[model samples]
Target: MRLTVRTNIAMRALMTCAVNPGKIVRKAEIAEATGASEAHLGVVINQLAQTGFIETIRGRNGGIRLRLPPEEISVGRVFRTFEANTPFAECFSARDNHCPIAPVCKLRNSLDTALEAFYASLDRVTLSDLTCNNAGLERLLSLEPVC
Candidate 1:
């Protein structure tokens, strides 16, 4: 199953925060590092804050930081939050489904099972798992000098 652009942006934002640790990372910094637009990052940042993953502040000194520890933030949970209400296929949507074979589509179940398995694999991973001791990600995500 393909992941949404929003989810991709969200992960990039999370990784940006993870690499910085205690810093209140600016949206512009994240956008520059991840090559995502500030407009799109703004929307995703609000969603991440609302979902209790990151905490935000206002004013000139304001920015964002992870509310939970990096190890505690499950990638699966983040994917679910962003991907919620987004059906993988027509048969997956209850209200919007227009599939003619909706009554007995074996493929839908298979897809669902596969999707769950995908999430399960991601569940084993966390922000820390993605960032820790990873020279490449730290180099890319860190706004500070990575020695």
Candidate 2:
């Protein structure tokens, strides 16, 4: 049930925007903060924008910002948007599964339940929940104190 590097980057980018609400964050800054390559961050940022999670302004003064309030962006929803095609286990993917017992495998069902529980827990948290009252995160990201 490991998350892809891209999914991890997307969450970091979103959290960067969440902590610095109302300001346009540069892609370079996000790349720097998240420790993702600029090229990779570019793709993830575009995907995030297209998914209605963030807004992008293209120009000399352009950058990115959260399209919705932090409280409105569910962590689970973001995860689903990027992870829709990700198979948790080889048995989860019909095209990739070669296990002979897949049809009657109890492990698959157990893994499914575990995956659902993972998402269910995430569903309880929003971007705001991840960033609330976290001064250390603000410092690490170099965000100004929210007034």
Candidate 3:
């Protein structure tokens, strides 16, 4: 299943915060490092904060940080947060479905099963699995800024 730009931005922001533990990492910092648009990042950041994935602080020292430990954060949960509202296919949308075979299509069930399997696989992985001990991710996402 294809993921959305919002999910991508959310993961990058989460990893940046995970790698930078105690620091209040700025959105510009995340955007610069991840090459994500600040405007899009702002929307993702707000959603992440609202869903309790990350916390945002206002002011000079303000920025963002993970509200829970990285190890406790589930990638699947994050994916679901950003992906659930979006229909997987044109036929998947209740209001927008225009498929003539909706009553006879068995493919939707198969697609749903496959999607759930994908999420289940990701559910086994935590943020720590993505960030911990990974020198490459640290170098790129560190608050210290890569040279």
Candidate 4:
């Protein structure tokens, strides 16, 4: 399923913060690094902060940092929070009352199972799992500047 740009960017920023841990990373730097617009990232950052994923600091030498440890931040939680309303099909939506097969659609049930499996797989991993290669990540970020 396709995720919104906001979700994608927010996940990246959160993972970046996870990689850096205690180090505060500026939003401008995040935007530049991720090739996302600072204006757009502001909104995502606000949402992430509200959802308790990250904390924001103001003034000079201020930036954002993950509120919880990377290992404690489940990928499933991130996906659910940022990628809301992610139904695999029309029949999977609770509000899709217009679907004629809604009452007896086995496909929807199967899809639900598949989606659950997908989420469960993600749940098994954490941001730290994604950032195991610190040196490689630093080199890549240095070269690309937009990881």
Best by lDDT: 3
TM-score (all chains, Cα) for each model:
0.95, 0.93, 0.96, 0.84
Query: How well is each residue in 44-104 modelled by candidate 4, as lDDT tens digits?
Result: 9999999998999999989999998888888887887876666567775678657987888
Model 4 weakest lDDT span, ten residues long: 138-147
Estimate, for each residue in 25-102, the C-alpha lDDT of model 1 and write its tens digit: 999999999999999899999999999999998899899999999999999999999998799998888899988888
Candidate 1: segments with Cα more than 4 A from true spot: 145-147
Ten residues in sequence with the least summed lDDT for candidate 2:
138-147
Decreasing TM-score order of the candidates: 3, 1, 2, 4
Cα lDDT of all candidates, in order?
Answer: 0.93, 0.89, 0.94, 0.80
What C-alpha lDDT, on a 0 to 100 scale, does residue 6 get in candidate 3?
99
In what order do the candidates fall by lDDT, top score first?
A: 3, 1, 2, 4
Q: lDDT score of model 4?
A: 0.80
Better of 2 and 3 by TM-score: 3
**Full-model lDDT, candidate 1:** 0.93
lDDT of 3 by residue, 1-147 (tens): 679999999999999999999999999999999999999999999999999999999998899999999999999999999999999998789999999999899999998999899999989899999999999999888878456
Q: How far is candidate 2 from the true structure (C-alpha RMSD, Å)?
A: 2.1
Candidate with top TM-score is 3
